[model samples]
Target: MAEEKAAENTAAQAAPQVQMRVLGQFIRDMSFENVMAQKGVSGDVQPEIAVQVNLDAKKRSAEHQYEVAIKLNLKSKAKGLEDILFLCEIDYCGLFHVEGVAEDQLHPFLLIECPRMLFPFLRRIVSDITRDGGYPPVNLDNIDFVALYRNELMRRQAEAQKTEA
Candidate 1:
């Protein structure tokens, strides 16, 4: 019985491991508006920044291939006066060839892991855009993908419940 158990364990251990490769990454769309440059601001300005993030994943026509995209909307304004400072919007996407991930877990894996992989490139773009737009570079903080996924699930559930009621 012990020998049989050992053989079973060995077989399970030999199962294929997950494999993921980034085929490519690119900016699907981007826009930056320097409101401060357009409408000059007078006095001391304290900038307040707001950022919104949205993620999407879709299967490509090719087998084991997926496309993951992230949309970022950023706005900056003077704190007290609420005068617009700048607005930046970007849609970035990555093409991934994935294998060995279980189908049940593929959704979260694509949404979370894929974005985590692409974030650094996206951050660099944001920093450059802000600095070139005449403001100091805005470095974004690290995102918590797990929390983001959970919040999205909860939001969808709440919306569904509201509609059903």
Candidate 2:
């Protein structure tokens, strides 16, 4: 029993530990435009709103620290009118510390896990900004980080193939 306990302790000590922590979060930039606010447009006209989201990550230091940024661009325009109703752009970033993750898994971890951690705050900011800008709150849908990452990978692969061709 003592030998078995010692073996288990040794195995536990030899196992690598993984840890992820958010150090800080901030808005890198924000822009809002109410293009038709002064035009006195009727409330009956509903505009089509388009939202785009992009993610980026960079290593902050030689250590396992990284900065992940989520960029959101939103534009709303009346269905048949060329005039835009409102536009919003926001860049939200988070500082993350990841330790003991394998080198091969690090890229996905940063792109997927870090953004997943920061998305709720980004969503809230978008909602608040749109509401405060005189329109209904823009509640962003939940993001699928894994799907995004996979799509990005496929895009890059296609680009590489195109270059080779």
Backbone Cα, N, C clashes tallied per candidate: 0, 0
Error of 1 at 38 (Å): 0.6
Model 2 spans with C-alpha error above 4 angstroms: 1-13, 38-40, 80-82
Best by TM-score: 1
* Model 2 TM-score, all chains together: 0.88
Once fitted onto the true fold, the runs of candidate 1 whose alpha carbons sit more than 4 angstroms away are 1-14, 42-44
Q: lDDT values of the candidates? A: 0.94, 0.92
RMSD to truth, every model: 2.2, 2.5
Looking at model 1, which ten-residue stretch has the lowest summed lDDT? 37-46
Query: Which whole-number lDDT from 0 to 100 does residue 105 have in model 1?
Result: 92
Per residue, candidate 1 scores C-alpha lDDT tens digits across 11-95 of 8888768999999999999999999888766666788999999999999999999999999999999887668999999999999
**Most lDDT-accurate candidate:** 1
Which digits, one per residue and each the tens of the lDDT, describe model 2 over residues 6-70?
A: 99999988877989999999999999998888777757657788988899999996588899999
